[model samples]
Target: MLLGSMARRVLANAEGERRAPRFVFVIQSNGFDAVQACPESIPFQKYADREKFEQLDLTQHKLPKGLAALEPLKGKTTIVQGLSGRSTGGGHSTHGGCLGLYRTSPASRSAHNATIDYELGRAAPGILPWIGVGMSAGQGDALMHYTARAPHKSMPIILSPEKAYNAYFSVAAGGDREKDFHLKRNLLDYMIGDVKKTRRALGSLGGEELDAYLSAYDELAARQYRLLANKDTLGKSAPKLDDRFTSDVATKRL
Candidate 1:
């Protein structure tokens, strides 16, 4: 009876599982020379006393079959490479290799948003949103997924597995959608007054300008209405994160 009650409670609270879960993952970027996860490929492991200058012909670890299994989802997943913040302020950290992504390091920046996931997940005219997951929660440092300097806000990284699981419901089902409807209604209401005012203002300026402005307004309104009707078709589906894939990405294995 206790088990049944617990299961019932969990189900009741499971936020609507509306669609496929979207996952965003951030990890400490690695260098090409990084050792593979396979034990056999570890060059540092064999060294009893290592000299800084010593060159080790190390073997590389290969990801297991479970990872290769994801080849089926290749089209769904777009592996983007070679992007960075426009500038790093020339700080020594600026000289940073792939490790530079975290913004601040040792563990690296947690929540800076520029890295692909958050951008992709953003709610827009037509797109699936994003959820950032932290795969690089090293003990010494903080974990955040989205990181942007200054004006850009940092997106908190999903740390706990439960947090990640719950977020799946949030993004998948389109969290607080009712609120969005209310908000859109309010926005349209607000636009009604401003739009009329703009028309009047344009008339005062000149007949030609008034006609052009109204025409532009009509075009804009049409675009907004189109977006409203076809919201689902507007964006790419958020990436479905498989556990095996996450494991492969972590530890520089991917």
Candidate 2:
């Protein structure tokens, strides 16, 4: 969610006024049947001819049953196939390696070195770099997934839509901006002092790491202050809340 928005923002900023390309990745837990998604108008045997590349004009052909819902978006929709994921270890799940393009196993430590999403997020920084949302079946409040942040670091997905909404959009919702700014300012001041105290107690190497962390917090605080200063502008673009945000059904929340 965050990645998509950031990408959109990047595209908007690139061309001064022209619309930019946007990307969205809709990943499902269970695998999807590729055959079912293929257009019936295209001969399946054509795929067997590895000697030649084939392209189909989907605009002239009826969409596959699985993709019928996208009929309205035919002009913008694209169907790409024949990509291989053989290099990624396959099981019930690929864990972090799915996006990282590395072999990651449950038993292995430091398996996921890096992921494409995080790399992209780093390249295009936003108010919220990345937002991961998921729905678990019978997990009972436990948000377990194979996503990763960095090597040996598993990223946590927000399972609850309400929580996700609050995390990302709360600032844009109507509120007393002055009060919020003061509260955040006080909190950041306290955190800076605490980080300094902790750094003083640490050794040289640890202190250096703490210094970096503290600097990051300082940068974040500055960004937050700037955002709060422009609360009126942001609030105009805030998303409207509805029942789906608080729905218990995973699909509704998603």
Candidate 3:
């Protein structure tokens, strides 16, 4: 999550402008039946005959049982289908393969390459650029591994609504925005200085690692500066805390 914010800030700092067209990837790990997502009015047998390209008018047809909830917003929604994903490999679960277009192994349990979400996140900048929130049946830790930030690196999903709320709305907590801002600013300044000192005393490989660290800290500092400048606007737009925001349930997190 921190990496995502820093990446966005870095892009803004480099370009001297904020980029439009932000992205949010809502990944559902569980398998979904494609037939159930299609319109009920469309015959499955006819649709399966994929020898040629075809387009269906959803307006004239009733939505499938699974997608009935979207009826109210169907006019605004675009349902895309008939896309081939054979290049990603066939399996019960494509894992990171569907996004990266590379085969992933359960035994390895890590991405062999960077996923599409990370690529888009790097291009678009925001306060919390790429938020990974979802429900999981797994126990112990609330983080459900989803997209990969880089090769062999899995991005952690926040499975708890309470934790996710705290992370996103920490600035609005206790109505002490000025104090929180200064504390973060001071911390970033300290880390930036420490990284610079360490980078000067390191070898080429070590220096390279420190350089990345330095860039992240620099971007964070810049983000802090911007936040401070827009503190009033932030407070005005901040969400109000409620039962939904404080809930620990996995479904609520979604």
Candidate 4:
């Protein structure tokens, strides 16, 4: 009986050690042709109707040329076709509405509702709840809003990997990077103080805009402190800085 109890405890421990599954959404702007991800084993003629639900097991079939790199992970991958978001607007991109399932355009700055990615990020909260990294063809573009947290709220996609790295891992990185991290923390402290003073000066006249500014500053300052508090633990697992992080090439940065 003791041996059986020990075995059950071991099994429970193993189950508890299992990591949570991560969900990743790969989106493409400028109209991604679904044919690019279609399996080579299936003929294009088979999909001409485009009115039926079709599923392909990646493990049993060869991936298309564009997705050839994912061959090794084919067994774990799934390719679904015939899904459409007609309400997202007709254009090269839907901006915020693609994930929110509402009508929005490139000129629109906000979303009609929280996107799936944002909801998932909230459900699986991290030190930084959701980190978005992307690259733009345009030169010197530092960010793009591709996701939304709620109505009138948009998430910033980090276009510069360097900036993203600094935001994520700099606190644990030694040398000048660590110093810079502390410097930013100190700046946040100063800014928080200044914001408090500004709030006092403006009184009720400050309105929601000033309150929003103060809230943003407070959130950033809190993050800085949290990182500093966990620096020792973070240092053990932080990724080492490499050329890929600083690369100018869009693909490499991604």
Candidate topping TM-score? 4
- Global fold similarity of model 4 (TM-score): 0.81
lDDT tens readout by residue for model 2, 110-210 = 44575777666656645444557778777654353355555655556677766665544556664663455567677987898889888877757575578
Per-candidate RMSD vs. true structure? 15.8, 6.0, 8.0, 5.2
lDDT of 3 by residue, 66-158 (tens): 778778867645677755556756665677776777865566556877788878877775654466776667644355335777776676677
Error of 4 at 45 (Å): 4.5
The TM-score of candidate 1 is 0.31
Clashing pairs in 2: none
- Top-scoring candidate (lDDT): 4
Q: Which portions of model 1 miss their true places by more than 4 Å?
A: 1-67, 74-113, 123-128, 136-142, 145-152, 170-254
Residue 215 in model 1: lDDT = 52
**Which runs of model 2 end up more than 4 angstroms from their true locations?**
1-15, 18-21, 43-51, 65-69, 109-111, 125-127, 140-149, 175-189, 205-234
- Tell me the whole-model lDDT of each prediction, alpha carbons only: 0.42, 0.65, 0.67, 0.76
Sort order, lDDT high to low: 4, 3, 2, 1
TM-score of each: 0.31, 0.71, 0.69, 0.81
lDDT of 1: 0.42
- Which 10 residues in a row give candidate 4 its minimum summed lDDT? 17-26
